[model samples]
Target: MPESLNRELLEVSAQVRGLLQDLQNLGFDEVPLAPPTAGLPRCGTAGRADGGEPGVSCRPESLEEIRADLENSPCCDLCRERGNLVFGVGDPHARLVLIGEAPGREEDETGEPFVGEAGRLLDRILSAMGLSREEVYLCNVLKCRPPGNRDPRPEEVAACRPFLERQLAAIAPEVIVTLGKCAAQALLQETTAVGELRGHWHEYRSIPVMPTYHPAYLLRNPASKREVWEDMKGVMKRLRGGGSR
Candidate 1:
């Protein structure tokens, strides 16, 4: 057996394990496996044991579907004060997904995440990385903005999590860059500050999640821009298949 093949197998196994962990964390304890053909060769976890509930083959959902649901279904009270749901915008098949905390005043008015001052800074950051907003998908932990740009409450985060999960599953980006403490904590389930979470590689359902300072923070503390750049560098390296922390 070739060493390269062995390494590939190990990597696949690790990804599978991470996926399982994330599913369990999301409260999906029993994942139904695919049913095996009687005389056909299958690969990976393609087949479930013959018996119980029939396996339902699931397919990736589209952003439009998720957005429509969110628009029609009021997840939390944030809707009453919101002008729009601000369901994500950008490339649906993008390899990179940038997640943020929640909508601000400008975002609430614009019906788009990251369209205000912080959004412009985010654009600059992407430019420095030799990318554009169109090149990567963008969204938030909470789709609707809280009143007065306040931090999202726990119940709000809980109510909106399912939508976020669907977006992630639909995009299935190779790397996830979460901007700020709210986005980071919501996804990674960490109570630590963004200062500590940044500059390291974390996993969210099998995808690499890089938590960094929010652009709003950068506006207040320009010095932290350096740290955010360092995190972006790591993200670029990972995207290039030259893995880094």
Candidate 2:
């Protein structure tokens, strides 16, 4: 064989080996050497790969659909006593999702997340980032408010986890801003303090997450606002396509 032809064959073999390794790492035991090409849409085309009609989306159920399914969910005791479910609010297609621990008295009464004192501070923070509440999706780790505004019990969080996960999947935001220890820990599945977690980048289901102090915490410790602002700047930077600082 010609030397040039041998070198080309070797490069192709290496590329195929790398592809096989990646498939194995992803839990695939076997891959068809010649997969079916029928019904597969070309890249950037409108046709569906599964032979579905053009312009039809195979994406998962939307947030509104999920919310409707969980509208009357009685999964926890908090749901029984709660005045409202407080599912979430804001643009369903938002690029940024702001998550907090749980709802407060004001939120529970109003059936909205982040509408109380902390919400006002959050408004200021959003303003600093040149954003509005309507521009970003907002929700809590737990849907229902804990009695007396206490931390969510483990069982409560466990019960409501599916709803949160569904929400994340439905929105599929580009960036997630966890606004306190509870929100951060819940999403990251870690027990790190907010001080340690903040000013750093974390991931949840492949989405970038920025953990920052809750607005309520800043209300008590005003000095921490600067730190939170720094964190928000990082979030803004990421949103603008500049990688995290």
Candidate 3:
């Protein structure tokens, strides 16, 4: 590796160490995590490439405990540059979860997910669905923004995977709608593109998932909004007891 890259990694490691120490100092250590139990979704390693199917280590009781657990588990280079961890926002017991790829400049600054131009479009989309931001949960596959708004690295995604699972397990949403290809593929553990995945019903830890074109994509390709609406209609039907197809 180049000297500069080595130095950068060292810096990120130091940052993680400091954060972990702070969390421990504030009494965030030795928090027990519940083992996987029967009757819930089988929380296997969706993103794991090792062909292992172990479930999530723990299922926190509430969003507060889940967030508290995350404070001590920093394990990514994004930690070095992030202003704040965009954990998530919305109802604690939401039946709907809208997940995106990751945070952008504005979200990284605000420490809230989906608060940019894309967020405005999402708000409008939510209104059309007869919902509000407070009615559903909003989050991302990756909590921190990549430097320069670039795509997230594989290591970064791995670092944040457990937190996302914990969130899903905590809220136990009835439906999940992935806003972009990245989020969909990450949760589904598939390589299929968004165009092929949208307008269909999929499963994530036994919860129903509906993939759709991202609002960011619609911003560039405005014609795709029609397709996105069609996909969301399916989600609404599922929520209204229409059942899965």
Candidate 4:
């Protein structure tokens, strides 16, 4: 056999093994193969799976639909303990989206993002940039507050990620600002420290992500506000069609 043919066969075998492994991971011991039918409608088409009556098109949900789903979701244990699910707020069509770690006590109580003292600092920062909370979309990596406002656990972040992903997809913001280490790491899928990640442009699924110090952090160390300002300037430059630093 030709060397190229042998290599292609090996690649095909690897792919097949990977598919089987994925099936196993999904709790499927075996997949029953079905013979192709001549008149069956395609999956996700406006018809039944077995080619019955026409059905509604399987399109992506709107932002409202996504929010409604999150609101009604009972999958997370955090939901049982949370006062409110702090789903994001702001313009659904905003060009920029601000992401944070999770809800704080005030946020959970008020059911709004950035409503605490840290939120006040965030407002000041936004005002300095000539923006407002209503002008940009704001959300968090986790919808529920952690016990005693501790950092989000890996399991919690994993469980909550789907909601954040759907929300981001629905909004499709041009630029994303990830506040604090946890939010930045979650969005970038990197473990780099926030101090190192800040003031640089990172990509999350093709969207530009600007990592910056969280307002809460800034409250603790007021000197770092200057650095956060510099990061915000980069975000502003991108929004205004200017080149990033």
Kindly list the per-residue Cα lDDT of model 4 for residues 162-221, writing each as its tens digit.
778778877778999999999998888889999999999999778899999999999999
- Tens-place lDDT per residue, model 3, 136-235, is 9999999888989888777788888778887887788999999988898888988999999998899998899999988999999999999999998999
The Cα error of candidate 1 at residue 175, in Å, is: 0.2
Q: Give the best candidate by TM-score.
A: 1
lDDT-superior candidate, 1 or 3: 1
Order of candidate numbers by lDDT, starting with the best:
1, 4, 2, 3
Colliding residue pairs in candidate 4 = none
After best superposition, candidate 1 residue 6: deviation in angstroms? 58
The runs of at least 3 residues in candidate 2 whose Cα sits more than 4 Å from the true structure, single-residue gaps closed, are 1-58
Query: After TM-score superposition, what is the CA distance of residue 243 in candidate 3 from its true location, in Å?
Result: 1.6
Off by over 4 Å in 1: 1-54
- Cα lDDT tens digits, model 1, 67-99, are 887888888899777987788889999999999
Q: Candidate 1, clashing residue pairs?
A: none
Writing each residue's lDDT as its tens digit, candidate 2 over 83-186 gives 88899999999999999998899999999999988999899889989999999999998888898999998888888877887788777799999999988988
lDDT of each: 0.87, 0.86, 0.86, 0.87
Model 4 TM-score on a 0 to 1 scale: 0.76
